[model samples]
Target: MDAAVSLLRRAEAAIPSGRGASALFAMLRPDDDPQSWRSTLNNDGAPYQIAVTDAGADASVRLIVDPFRLGRDEADRVGRNLAAFDRIAHRCSSAAAARCRRFMAALAPSFEEGCERRSGDIWLAALPGAAGVGIYVTARGRAPQIQCTRLIAAAGLDHHRAAIAAIHAYGAVEAYSIQGSRCDDLAINIYWKPRGGTPLPPAINFEPPALSPGSPPTALARAPLGAMTLCSTFAVLGSGRGSKIDLCNHCLGLDLAASLEILGRFCDLSPAFVRGAGDMLAGEDAEIAFLGVRVRPSGDRAYLYLKPAASACQSVPHLVEGATCR
Candidate 1:
């Protein structure tokens, strides 16, 4: 049931734009024992239904996206891409750890194509072997003309493991971590610049603020490419049972995807739920208004600058003496 809901939400959030877009959801169950396995497909009024008898009593899902939403050519492209994914979705639903890695590697080519088209970021998730979940995030422009895949670990949120590595290696400017109260999880979001790329906003001279020994502030670092925050959350979902997806649409998708992928790594399939309402993916960039004064640009050796937020300045007295937001 949890898996079914997650995919439903993901389908709604996966696309870059929702205008004219519609999806058909279907689940398979044993006819003999319908009570043992049941499924739900909540469409917002459009008419669609499908039934199939398979041994997926645990769970089975198929999503039909309306090609009309993307127009003729693009629609055809997306349709082909989705068809490839559908072929493997069932196998992914029950693949093991080794199989998951292989699945990701095999799917890399398709994702690489998605990146090449580069209208928006492409993301997909699946439960490998009913124990863990896997999400693949493929973006372009960071490492232009090259396909680089990084393994991100959910447990390494504090140190900003993969996020930091991607930033430095790929010259990514926009990065941050969010610590949400609603969900016990961390969101390490990032935007990247291609290798040998020039600064987006010309340049300036500034320095990054030093964090206190204890907990750091919301705004993390500002670099030539952009600014990054490694936000920490107060909530912790132990065993991932009954976890709520109560966050903004963009973040909700990211948080749920990341958490599930990490949980799947541990092969821990506990009950989880997405409590809040949301939308399909919007073409617009995610709202990053919360990191006021934490991000600044510079043309220095670091290629970027950072400063403490007003709250951070007040909390850490040392930052106030020489800190400047300009």
Candidate 2:
């Protein structure tokens, strides 16, 4: 308990503050209900109310920070949104990082709004293992950026370089990735979005013979000419051609067709591929890549080859040419 308090204090101290801005923290032990634990200094000293009151069995610990003071209606909405976060933390604890990200994108509308002064809240959860997940939304310029990353903590926050980068880069960079572990095949994906713009994608770098160490499951290779910023990243395991799904299409607010199309363009895949792979890539060892854009295995099975895109830029050189295709 003392340790958690220290972490929250550190987080609150590090974050910038404004006149009407505020923050909240929630913590839960295994099988225990969530409790309002700590908070940052409220600029207006407004009486704080319980915002999110729910937690899941899978989520052992969750820390959320709402940067803005909320109205009654807004607080209720934020509470509901945090429930979605709780569900995602449980689902992502064992599933691939991409799957977790898809769930988050699906609930983007539930997030707190970001105007000129304040941005959306931040939510982070740590599972029993060294693995965890985090999401942050930014209100910068005319666009808002949403970033999510899979966590692998060696000891403390010192090991989470990508997380620190995201915190410092909140208003600056669009997206980037960090090497999670040198020995294990763990990498963090970072995606960036321009407010209403489609979610920016992580850069996937696949090298021949041996894939790039710490390469994410589903990522778009960064182009030299057009520097694409990252928006969110999911943890993926394996090297074979895998499947993908876009949860944004299934969510509310945005047009379903438009969301699906936007997600398709993010990976340079087709709408059919995005729609087909929905909720299917949640399994382990799901090797996901765009057909012509990344890797194309020799097979007619949709599972064997991601939908091909003639206009898709071949991000990296394919080594085996589907010689290892399942």
User: Which candidate wins on lDDT?
Assistant: 2
Q: For residues 1-326, write the lDDT of model 1, one tens digit per residue.
A: 11222323333343222111122222211111222211111111111111100111121222222111121354454554344344335442332333333433432334344434322222332222222222233333344213223323332333334334444454533222112112333222333333435532211111233333543222222122222322111112332211111111112223334433322332323221111111211212111111111221221010001111223223323222332111
- How high is the CA lDDT of each candidate model? 0.26, 0.29
User: Which residue segments of model 2 deviate by more than 4 Å?
Assistant: 1-77, 87-90, 93-136, 139-157, 160-171, 175-188, 192-227, 230-326
How well does candidate 1 score on lDDT at residue 151?
25
Model 2 C-alpha lDDT per residue in residues 71-126, reported as the tens digit of each score: 23555645544554554355243444444344334333332342222323333333
Give the 10-residue window scoring lowest on summed lDDT in candidate 2.
45-54
In model 1, how many backbone clashes occur? Answer: 20
Question: Which model scores highest in TM-score?
Answer: 2
